[model samples]
Target chain A: MKRLLKTVKNNFLSVFFIVYIAVGMVSVCKPQALNIIDGFLQSDRSLSYLIKAPVLKLLDIRYGGVNLEPDIKLKAFYIHLNRLIQRVIGNDYIYDAGPKNDVVRLNNGYLTTCLPKLTD
Target chain B: MLFSSTVFLFAFLPVVIFGYYVIFRKSRLLQNIFLLIMSLIFYAWGEPKFVLVMMLSIIVNWALGLPAAKYRDNKVRARAVIAAAAVFNIGLMFIFKYLIFTLENINSVFGLQIPVPQITLPIGISFFTFQAFSYVIDVYRNDGEMQKNPLNVGLYISFFPQLIAGPIVRYQTVANEIKNRKETLSDFTTGVERFIVGFLKKVMLANTMAVVADAAFDAKDAISPSFAWLGALAYTFQIFFDFAGYSDMGIGLGRMFGFHFLENFDYPYISKSITEFWRRWHISLGTWFRDYVYFPLGGSRVNSKARLVFNLFVVWFLTGVWHGANWTFLVWGLMYFVILTVEKLSGIPKKEGRLLIIPKYIYTMLLVIFGWVIFRAESLGAAGEYFKAMFGFNGGTFISDDTVFYLKNNLVMFVASAVFSLPVAPLLRKKLMSAGERTRRAADAAYTAALLLMFVVAVSYMIKGTYNPFIYFNF
Candidate 1:
């Protein structure tokens, strides 16, 4: 018991990180938990912006900001977690049904780009 | 599951570590059994049905291993046992890995329309099968003790760390450790640090380079000469960091559980000759071919130059075919065979003096980069087209805006990859070892901080859903 305690004490940081990761995993599975995290992040405007601005910019590039729903302040967070879950289950889901800037359309045997447009 | 995946990092690894160290700490047998179960779970997470394939391998090898050791005094029976083991293991690999490729080739050659079977390869079939063969051979040769328990054999063969993509841990390397090895705090901490470094290498360096390499290789038309070189160089670094990073993580994870795997790579990019390059690159697989294939075929004890060439041809041909069922891999292996054979016959690498080091280094790297081009291509014709573009024979521009854009965006990462691929880490450790106690302590603290930062950044990349592809998993 003493040895076990000693090992635990020595590895306190590892335990904390593991717990944090577990919580993150659970949060992704639970939309309500993600909403809570979003509420927490939104409590501080500058901090939320600092954490979210680059993510939104990246989403803008790949997904054209189609998932920027009004209710979900951490839309990217949710999408990222959902995508991970989908991948783990071996299903590649396309979250953005909106205009994909990279996809080309075949218009009468000629290729044309799908022009960039933000749906949200 | 990929080591870089969130599922592995966040769920699988932590749980296994906790169970092993906390629950089964005092019991080696239980720990081994626990590890085996967890390893199966780890593999099953990717493909549930393939678990049966691995279990089949474990059971057959274990059964063969007993007779292999028992009938060692009888030459005929022993030879038969070993041959049966080889046929079973190789036949497994052949059906899953090579049957389709072989059928297609045969059909094309004979002008017949034989239908190839649709088979999904079990992940890491090559790695586990090779490890299984090593076990039986090691038991037969008395290089390692034969496990009486089938579960122990299963644990040795299916241990998750090196199971998927391996340094190809031989039975002799961990035979003793399997039964009686001590896990220490110091080893655990060092293992954590090593795992973090590998995570950074995979998630940051290799993935970033994959972006550039994929762009260049997957271009619809011929790319500029500069872009071709950049893509080739990117792929060179990408393969190194990807495989080496996985090896580091495997070794680190092995250490975390008191199993020490052999080092797979040793700064292979820094080699001055192709001979030296093979010596340092994928050392496990190279040594595997050397011991099991080359030595059994009279190795370097041949009488004639033709014999030596024949021996090398077999090894390199199998080495290429072992990588994938692609003609590209065969050509890549043959390319090395040609270079290494010339080096060996002429004794040039051995005879060269220190003055020619730079030239030798440049020559080796150029060949290696070109070799990667072949390895990365979809077909020989595609590789030829890539070479044409690389040499400005495709009427492609020398330098284009696309080339400049990629170079500018990835300059820092490219420089970092080049510097880290050298012996910088070892040199820094050597310097730190000579420092004062207080300074050493400070350096240790800084090292821990850096590791934490790297872990954060790597996990963030995982969360961000980046282009994280593992190259060696196909092999």
Candidate 2:
């Protein structure tokens, strides 16, 4: 214990991080303290993770509740929209930089709407 | 997975730290077993199916080490087994990483329809394969005694720190520690601090730089000349912090586990020449090739100039190929070779008068910045386009509104990157050591608080799930 303190006693950065990690441990122990960060970010862990911006903005799901619901309406709309677009465009054609690829769909090899649109 | 991940930070790291220290503290054997399993779990989490590939690597290397060691005196059998082990490691890398690349090139050139076996590269295959190769080769060379215990050998190869990315710790370096290691609170605390530094570098600087760099390269239209330069500079900083930061994290993590791995980077950007840059950058890999490959081929001690050139070519070519399956990496490696060749033939003293030093620095940075363009580009075509943009070859505008916007917005980041990329931490400690106790203590707290705040901000950024993979993960 003396050795630990002796080492920490000299280095201020060590002192700070020790306290910092200790605080994180405290937050882990008291989950309510972890909720403080949630005020800045999305309340749901998975939803917060899904948000891909650099800033800690709220996930603006239109549904309002204590218990969260998946955005089923938005999901269905995108699916139907994509289908309609595909039908209109027919085979081998699609809009460039439209919401079809980047927004609602996970990349599944066949129709990834990300960079390098050309396969070769 | 990624060391910078929420899962790795909050879940995997903390849990493993607790389990290794608290639960298995009393039993060394239990700790070893615990760590082996945990490390396996860690690798598996990232490359689930390739966990078997890694285990097979460990098993084959571990099995081969005995024979290589046993036949150390017998010339014929020793060379055969070593050759076989090398083949196995290199062969695994070729089939997985290079086969598709080879087939594509062949098909393109010969005008044949060879079906491409395009598979996603197994993560860390290069790192682990080289590590496994090091073990067998080191044993053959009698650099380290052969470990009889397969688990110990497995631990040496698959230790979580430096597993995916590396300083490429030589077997001889950790052979003893694999058998016996002691964890101290001092080392643990230092490790924590080092990890935080690395985490901040990755999360803050590298990732931010990546956003700008990726934007410039992936621009729908050709970016302005200045934007090309800006992207190139950002990528220069990005690759440095991204890889060096990962190395620090790896070293720090190794410290927590009582393994003292060597330093990997030494501020290569500070160098005045390309020769010095290679020395400071990726020191372990440089040394590995020097000792194992270069020295065997007569290194610089060859009688003829041709032999010396051949040695350098082999080393650099291998160095470049070791980076990726792509021709770009090979070219990137050869570019360095050509520069060094010119430097050698020119016979101009690298060390210049103080007045000439600035020009030397500019020369080094220019080549490196251009080299990184080749490195960061998706293809030779993209690289050519980027070069044209950088030099204003066909002519776009000098600067774009977006370029000015990025510079203005990221002014602080640019300044911070330049300042911190030097040996700032050590410099701070040196200056602080002479200050009065109270002053030093206050400075410490201030630095610590700043780091804590940085971590909080970085965590917030991370929770937003920004694109934050280490660039070397591709390598």
- The RMSD of every model to the true structure, in order and in angstroms, is 9.8, 10.8
Per-residue lDDT for B236-315 in model 1, tens only? 99999999999999998898888888899999999998999999999999999999999999887999989999999999
Candidate 1 docking band: incorrect
Kindly report which residue stretches of model 1 are placed more than 4 angstroms away from their true locations once superposed.
A1-120
Worst 10-residue lDDT window for candidate 1 chain B reads B457-466
User: Highest lDDT among the candidates is held by which one?
Assistant: 1
* Residue lDDT tens for model 2, B355-471: 978898899899999999998898889999999998898575798886886676466667778888888888889999999999997887787677766676655445433368777
TM-score of 2: 0.82
DockQ-based CAPRI category assigned to the predicted complex of candidate 2: incorrect
The per-model lDDT (C-alpha) reads 0.82, 0.77
User: In candidate 2, which residue ranges exceed 4 Å CA deviation?
Assistant: A1-120, B347-349, B436-438
Clash count, predicted structure 2: 0
Query: Could you tell me which 10 consecutive residues in candidate 2 chain B have the lowest summed lDDT?
Result: B457-466
Which one wins on TM-score? 1
Candidate 1 lDDT at B16 equals 91
lDDT score at residue B348, model 2, on the 0-100 scale: 47
Q: How high is the lDDT of residue B432 in model 2? A: 96
Q: State candidate 1's DockQ.
A: 0.07
